[model samples]
Target: MALSEREQQVLRDLESQLHQEDPGLADTMDSRTTGPLRLSPRHIGAGVALVLVGMSLVVGGVVVRNSVISILLGVVGFGMAVWGVTLALTRVEAGGGPGSSRRPSRRSSFMDRQSQRWDRRRGSQG
Candidate 1:
């Protein structure tokens, strides 16, 4: 999904506000996190090559009249092809990507409160 120009501007404005309020945090967040799982051309190529090799292996086994070997090669080829397709189709974005700038939800707030309480309790006991 692509963001509209207005939405992009809003995000930029929010980021500026954040930077002004917390320069230290802003500096810490300057790193570009890797985007989601995307199959690079290299990975796709490697996967395709693997599938091809496996298929060839299966064909060779069949030519040699070895049922067990043929079956094993076929399974390997299928698995490799599936893995390649999955890698190519699935994409995951890391931090700094779209929708990553949103504030934490209520559940996250609750978890933070609970963690703080636990820390306080431990400190008092100690």
Candidate 2:
């Protein structure tokens, strides 16, 4: 289901706050993370191609009177076509590429900064 206007507003507000606090955090988020895969056309085409290839193999087997090899080849072709179609629908890279600035996931940058500030205050107090 689609997000309601109010829900969208809330999300935007939260994102705005995040951006205000962290300059480059929004760049880390993938725009397509929430969107649909949109694989309908490719999926349908793959299904139809699979069916056709399998049917052809079956018919060829009947003609040649060799069911085993025909079934195997057809199954392989169908699997490959379906895999290709699935790959086509998927995106290449998720987040921003090499040039894109990324915050260190393991770095406790925020907490470390706050702690440093606290240490400075404690030193000054002493």
Candidate 3:
């Protein structure tokens, strides 16, 4: 349900107060985005390279005669493929970019708040 004008105004006031009191927290909260994952070209390139190398290794493993060597190669190849997939699927942060340095304390505090909320929810459920 949509908020009424009065509720909206109150929310705005609260947000303004939050910004004034803790600008870092406000900024971090505002920077959060939802929806589709955005992948960078660099990530795509690296992930693809790893995946290709992995595929080649897997193929080589299948062709090899020795069971021990084949098994090792196959395991490594599977690991590399999974890593590549994970890297490729990872979302890039939009607002700050990867290079922008944020206060460590702010992040930890936000995480702590989320953890507390999760704990509270679980406690209520159980």
Candidate 4:
């Protein structure tokens, strides 16, 4: 059987309260969010671009028959490629800000009513 009108109303009221409390909580937890942890092909492409540029430099050095310059370009190009790829693929944690139950942060943990005691002690020393 369908839910009674009262049951539906209660659900709606609870939803309203929850949304008002944290408007984006639903969006954050959406499985479709995919987090910010993965790298896209575009990131890899950029790194490869760096490598190509470095390879071109090496080619130029070759035309001049300069082994030292070729080596330098190769090193620079390889470094750029590595750095670009590294930067593109980092992920940060997802927290439900404020009242979302993630628990206290390292900084916030030590900043509670204990501050009052510390303040009183400091005041006495002053």
Candidate 5:
């Protein structure tokens, strides 16, 4: 069901108040924002290409008659394939790349609070 205009206004007001009171919490709760890890088409394409080239090199190494050259080619091919797979699986950050100036969200703060509680409990028990 669609929200009525009055309900939408109320929600907006509530959201604004939340942001004003606790920006970290608001950010954490906001579903509109993207997460840290995002897939990159460019990276996927490059990784796939590398994997294919690596596989071909391995095949070529197998077909070659020379033992030393075949071994070298095979090793190189394996390395390339591994690198390609790693690249393909890697994801880019959503916001301003790594080491951005953005404040830590409520999630981290919550985790920190939990850790602190755990530590205190441990100290008490010990």
Candidate 6:
């Protein structure tokens, strides 16, 4: 059921009061809702362990001389390894949260360059 207009206003007022009363709790709640998944060192370690288990599965499949299973397991292992690396290295920050004043880097990948070109074309036409 939709909230009535008065109920909506009351909810907004409560939220504003919450921010004013306990800023730390507000920040934690905001981070949980708006922030990226902040993986800890232990989480990254678990991801590495998962990659190792996937590799072992691939090796066992190969020993059993199952081509299909071996290929599938190998692919899974590769994906897990890539995921672990990403978890280890990725730095996620909320937009305009902190240190957001830095200028964008000029380096552009092939896809980035193509996307920029497409955007410019659309902008000029419009």
Q: Pick the candidate with the highest TM-score.
A: 3
The better-scoring model by TM-score among 2 and 6 is 6
Question: Following a full C-alpha superposition, what root-mean-square deviation does model 5 have from the true structure?
Answer: 13.7
Tens-digit lDDT string for candidate 2 (30-123): 4445543444544456666666665665556556646687667666666665665554454433323234345443255777998899999999
Please identify model 3 stretches exceeding 4 Å from their true place: 6-28, 34-37, 95-126
What is the C-alpha lDDT profile of model 5 across 6-117, one tens digit per residue? 9999999999999999998998777445566776777788899999999999999999999999999999999999999999888876543455535456567888999999
| Cα misplacement distance, residue 114 of candidate 6 (Å) | 52
| Residue-level lDDT tens digits of model 4 in 24-76 | 88556544465444445555676667666756665665675577877777677
| Per-model TM against the reference | 0.36, 0.31, 0.55, 0.33, 0.49, 0.37
Q: Which residue ranges in model 6 land beyond 4 Å of their true spot? A: 1-39, 92-126
Which tens-of-lDDT digit does each residue in 1-126 have in candidate 1?
Answer: 999999999999998998999988877676334234444555456667766765676566577667787777777767766776665554443322245466445657888999999999999999
3: Cα error in model 1, Å: 14
- Model 1, residue 58: distance off in Å is 2.8
Clashing pairs in 6: none
- Candidate 5 TM-score versus the reference: 0.49
Which regions of candidate 1 deviate over 4 angstroms? 1-39, 92-126
Q: Clashes in each model (backbone N, CA, C under 3 Å)?
A: 3, 0, 0, 0, 0, 0
RMSD of 3: 16.2
Q: How many angstroms is residue 21 displaced in model 5 relative to the true structure, after the best TM-score fit?
A: 25
Candidate 5 Cα outliers beyond 4 Å, as residue runs: 1-34, 96-126
Query: Using lDDT as the measure, what is the rank order of every candidate, best first?
Result: 5, 3, 6, 1, 4, 2
The candidate maximizing lDDT is: 5
Better of 2 and 4 by TM-score: 4
Residue 42 lDDT (model 6): 56
For candidate 4, report its TM-score. Answer: 0.33
lDDT of each: 0.68, 0.63, 0.83, 0.65, 0.85, 0.71
